[model samples]
Target: MSLAIVDAREWQNLLDLRTGKKVKDDDPRVQAPQTATLRDVLRRHPYPGDSDPRSNRWVTDSALDLVAAYEPQLACVVYGHQYFAGRYTPMTDVQRKGMMEELFAEIDRFVARSGYEPVVVGTGDMVPLEGEIDLGKLEGLAISSHWSARYAGLHRATPRDLDHVRSLAKVERVVGRDEWLAAFPDAEAVPARVPEHLLLAEEGWTFVTTGTPMRRPVRVPGRGFRIPLSTRLGAAPSLLDIRGLVLSGAAAGKKVALIVAEGVGMNDFLLPFTPCANQTGWHYYEPGDGFYLTLSTGRHQVFAYPSGYNYLDETDEKKDLPFSGYFLDFPAHALGDDFPGKSVAAGNHSMFVHMVFGADVCMECFARNLYNQGGFGVIHRFR
Candidate 1:
């Protein structure tokens, strides 16, 4: 059953309230009216399918109902352009404040009607909730980062290279390997010798860096490239091979599946990672305690917490992080004949799964930025 009714007219009013300007037909916020079910909406505008969430014209009551049905115990509602219009467009400070107020009021109304006391979060104005609330306690679900796979790319960075690149900038993250090498041309070997594991297919050529310290000192530019690196890299690997399976259904047993991926974010709690989780989920935990992913199928519930730490962080007390390895009572199913083909259909998203055999593996994968703005989530429901 559907949970709530979402009318485009209501959305238009919210946008109007936030922007304090009448939305004209030409306005990007203005979308045509075409009512449909949440499933249909998702099917038409699947993650990595539609570039703009607002363009779907189906972010109405049906979408909310779908989410509410999937997670009935949901106690928090994070409203953003995904909820109201779409993200990536520009907005003024006044508009942002107005949008936050509108979202809060709408969430309050939803709570009153549904009897679900959900914490309302404005993507633009996320503040620490002290002792009153813990976002981690709330299921980290969001549609904002459900980006199309077309824009997705796997960034690669080795431990030493990443450190050298990050040292050149004050920001916590860099764009990709090329940008780092581009800014520091000397870092790029004339012959281009890179570790076998780090070699990318697109680059075509590879160069080896020699020396005992493993440090190839190059002439530093007088001024570092001040521009933040592009979060999107052309030569990065593709996540299309990553797959999800329901080894044990939430109904029969706790959901379990074998996940084969290149790396895991230090602050990331959930597997089959999402960009939004990386961007916002980190704030939910303290230094030591990692994040959590709770799964349910109306009859049973299972929780997956981070049991291992892997990633290169300069500020971290421990310098060398371990290679990614995870084992759990609720384990990930191995990819085999039973493995569901190259792609698994989830809601409206068609997640493509790739299998890596033998020794060729990616150990150091880049953590993507919010700019890609596209990601996919899967809820494996087994009978």
Candidate 2:
């Protein structure tokens, strides 16, 4: 099994006690050297572009625009931390849906191009997705809590939820122990849904997933012991038309999300069919009430800031255009907000404005002017 641990050291870095417990931007404690850690992992993989195994890390894609970048044809598996990396908050259900929707859309493209499916297992965090799934009509449902079983230090599982999903998916056939590995050698035995042999066809690369038939345990801060949750809320229920709902967003015209790690050795993701960049390249909202058309219940305030149009310029090369930035604050209900008033949730408090890259706005030239005027990094494109 090709196992790639993403942000393992970074996770450790953030969790380190010496640092403040919370991981956030502007925190200097977690800023230890990460390049070395990234390079060490990439060394094991085949390097593409100007291949040289001796050089531990791969080249930065600038904006993650390069293709034919990776050398290995292996399945490009991505592992991410749920609480921090996944960027979830307790208050927003829309953002939670958007996050997974974005992830699924990104993975679908990778699967189509690379012929390898992206596996999304758990990363020990039991933060619910903040959304609801209707499973009353389904025959059963199965939920897998952790990512790859072998890679998890703390064993976590959810069997009852798995059975619910199985009922909903109408899954039949549980592979017996004797023929399980032989039939589906590559597939991990998931305690939910169909058995190993039942899932595999005569030939096809298989992905194995397993979950403990137990509720995930969660610890309340300042509390003494961990409590078992009924089910993993993040686990999406498999439905009859599940394929249709899953693939609808991948239809077309969607701007691909390109994730790049400058010094970190984690592989960059060239995700097409992912959500388009926000007006300022920060927030992604559902287009409409329908799966694809749903927009956010509230709009972000940062979009009101003037976005920089560097693509308007013709010559400067030193400045980096923002493909996307981070959120300054979650939406707040106070005045000076633009989100729909009907929304019970507060308006977006603030957002990170990412400048457009390449020749789109001639931003390269614009950035030089902005920097010369000592106005660099100020949102200005909207104006």
Candidate 3:
């Protein structure tokens, strides 16, 4: 009993409304005669899968940009021309493996100067490497599906298989499709820039879902669905600025993970912990009370509250700012608004999860940002 909640036509309708591009109602050219539904749209625009040929041109740029926005420390490469890709290509499995190896080495060199790690994102097929890559030694990593993976007649990777590959790489998520492959009426092709502009324009709706079963909030068969973020974008609690902590060692010892609330923004909460003090990094305090910093040396430090019961600000008499070994900071940008206060006409719910770490350092600002997005509801130190 799968639920069909969002419709693909909604994608076109929302695109038209946001861009002011007039798409005909039931226009046969956009493939309307057969009445393509949201499920059909979803199939075509599968999650984690590469975009269709028509949609690939713009999506690649958007996808690369999206990865860069979050993982600034990581680098990438875009391979395979649109026309020459797909399983039917004359390339052999060994030849493809060699191609990937060469590409991976190039990314390694790019990050070598910066002392960061690079992960290769590809379009189709999830190949597992027999050896493990020392991710901690590298800055960060990312891999994704290629556009050719979405072709109607090509061999594409499945989410289940992708999930397995992610586990091998210790990655938790993969952007992928929600349903099977679909077909639609032939009409004016959706411009490559449409989806990118819609997201950037903030014309669609954003939904938040919490503590619900996976795949709930089923959509109506024909309506389009919304892009459900894992966390929210509300203003976070103010805390000590983290820009100055300036840890001298490599980030190899510094750890960070995502703590997301269903349908919320990505930076909802980032908590790095250490058990040097209480064997648990969870900070507990009463309302209006200041949070103490417990150092690895067993020393206790205190922070004072501002007049408004928030973190210490200018008006507070406490001249000393207690340095919490951990720091917190909000993401620099929100999805932004379409035209100001207009609800993004989206059709899905959000997903939520908390970040748990095993080590700790100065992370006050980082923790505060997470708590501000949506109070840190859960804390776990291990996966």
Question: What does candidate 1's lDDT look like per residue over 305-343, in tens digits?
Answer: 211111111124322211111211122332222332221
In model 3, where do residues sit more than 4 Å from their true spots? Answer: 1-88, 119-383
TM-score of 1: 0.28
In candidate 2, what are the lDDT values of residues 107-155, reduced to their tens digit? 4544355432222221122332222223233223222222111111111
lDDT of 2: 0.21
Clashes of each: 19, 51, 63
Candidate 1: RMSD over Cα atoms?
A: 20.5
TM-score of each: 0.28, 0.20, 0.19
How far does residue 350 in candidate 3 sit from its true spot (Å)?
27
lDDT of each: 0.22, 0.21, 0.20
Better of 2 and 3 by lDDT: 2
